[model samples]
Target: MEGRQLQQVLNTQRLKSLQEWMQESSITLTQVNGQRKYGGPPPGWQGPVPGPGCEVFISQIPRDVYEDRLIPLFQSIGTIYEFRLMMNFSGQNRGFAYAKYGDPLTASTAVMTLHHYRLPEGGCLTVRKSTEKRQLRLGDLPTSINQLELLTVLRMLSDGVEEVLLKMAGPKGREVVALVNYSSHYAASMAKKVLAQAFKKHYGISITVKWTSFSKSKHVSETGQEDGTFTPPGLSPLPKPSITPPHLHPKPSLQDVPAHPPLQSFFRAVGSPAGLPRDEMKPQGPVNRDAVSLLQWMCEVNRLGTPRYEVRFHHASSDGFLCFSYEVLIPCFLIPLYGVIQILPGPSVQATKEEVYRAVAELVIQTICKVSNARPF
Candidate 1:
């Protein structure tokens, strides 16, 4: 047993060691691939080298489309090494993305096949090999404009805003420089035109908007530039509408009771007076006449004084007594039955004619049993 246990422990240790070795090798392989990709392919790496051909730019993506949706769509053509859907800080899709496939051939095939492909949800895709070495950036935005306002203004004019970076240009951080990353080149251009016009008209200042090449070394400024030269244009304020007074109606007197008297009488009849016995109030026979009459009246009122239920007394052979069966129009009888049961104690009675019949039968049985038990032997 000791030898067997030792052997099992050794096996477990070996398995763990193998797993660790595999993980380390994977990390090393990934590092090698990264070096080759960013730097250059290693010595003796054969055949037409994989360049930007392995990466494809997809545009006109719907706002709802995310990385998960894009993966399945492109997986048919190639294995995705990297899938990224650019999103703003608010987590909204920027409507464009870059997907890098495992091989250049696969990437090229995907580009050709998916280009101008109409999505079921809406929008035709514009797929192509990404040639633009730098991401498009918009500059010369008002420093006074915050990220939210900038996004709103850009969205009003363009399709979507991917990112926004603020910086201070002049000495002592006096000038604010806002850099915005738009999804597509066309969207960026459109925003530039629209915003330039808007600023010129609203603020009476010419806002310079231009695209900048992507740079890894370029870091977004942490602090905003406080420049008094130009103030950001605010949204046009609207005048608040005046509130209207609600119409009031006079309370009806007791003499006007005929209109709504049935409902009031239905509730009053179901409830017992202070001196009344609770047990005697059970629906056994003519003892609960008030309750029965009120319930019937309520049903009549509901059906416009028409009888909506058929009440029949069945003779029970075993008990030698009559059992009541109520066949009622479900909708018409339920409203009053609900009010009748509310005044009674114990479990809540169901709003059904059959339920009412069952309750009445059970009450009769209990009353009979109580009287029989009360008699002397």
Candidate 2:
């Protein structure tokens, strides 16, 4: 086969795989309305395409220079289709602008030819395509729908999302805006299509969607003190930004609790188990070694249909081995077990030899109680 034929075959296979994956996951990708055809699909099968002119998002420009001033600079290279200068509450320029050109080839050429070329001396121009194609400015979100519920709805529509920003957009008692983050441009594009239908029906709230820069929607307030210094909120006096680490940024996961401890520490804590009684030293109790095995099998079998039990797997070691354990004790409610409470009699090998056996015992007890309770899902 010719090289171009082989490439075409490969592209067709890739698109087929993507469509299959979407169908299995219950996502349907349809054509978008008002989608201008500036360029063909990304070197392959026919589908919704992005226009040739890249969305050039600019920032840090003087307010005095409005849309009229920018058009000539941009149109010099290509036919400018749309130009917008964003404004803030005070009717002042937000120091940002967006320009969409008519032709993708011309847009690409312009981006390559005119970047960072100082505009007649001291003036500077920073240009690049916008990362976010479009976003829904969700408002009046029902307070009943918390963060998790909203995220679940979005995940059902897209492949996977990076982050979801929820904030109060109105007065204290009502209204909020959620900035949904998708994994890629295609996923965002797909999400923008499906969200309006899903949201209105489920939440009774209609959101406004627009092609805007995500950076502009991200708001962070740095507080300053009476002493004339800036600080984090709740801190009396602020500190200098220069002293802060360049890599330091507010990440939501910083607040998340890790499920497992380091392997070395875990092993060091479970170094050895208590010596069995003299009679049981032979690795057999009235409940023989086989009984221990049978009891463990039952726990595993019962877990499959158990409603109350929350089962999770973890690794405390570098070796590809898992720690299979269940909690027994109910920390909040110290209710003793009434029925036949069965368990394997020995320390779990998953833990390090130096670990405390009693903690493992406690965990087993907690697991049973929690899993058995008729509680909220």
Local accuracy by lDDT, each model: 0.43, 0.39
Q: How do all models score by TM-score?
A: 0.26, 0.28
RMSD each, Å:
33.0, 22.7
lDDT of 1 by residue, 110-159 (tens): 98899999987689988887642212334455444454344433433344
Per-residue lDDT of 21 in model 2? 59
* Candidate 2 Cα misplacement greater than 4 A, ranges: 1-32, 36-110, 114-128, 131-135, 202-377
Question: Which candidate number would show the highest TM-score if scored against the true structure?
Answer: 2
Q: What is the lDDT of candidate 2?
A: 0.39
Backbone collisions counted per model? 0, 27
Candidate 2 on 13-77: residue-level lDDT in tens?
Answer: 43465456555645332222222112112122222222433556565555444443455577688
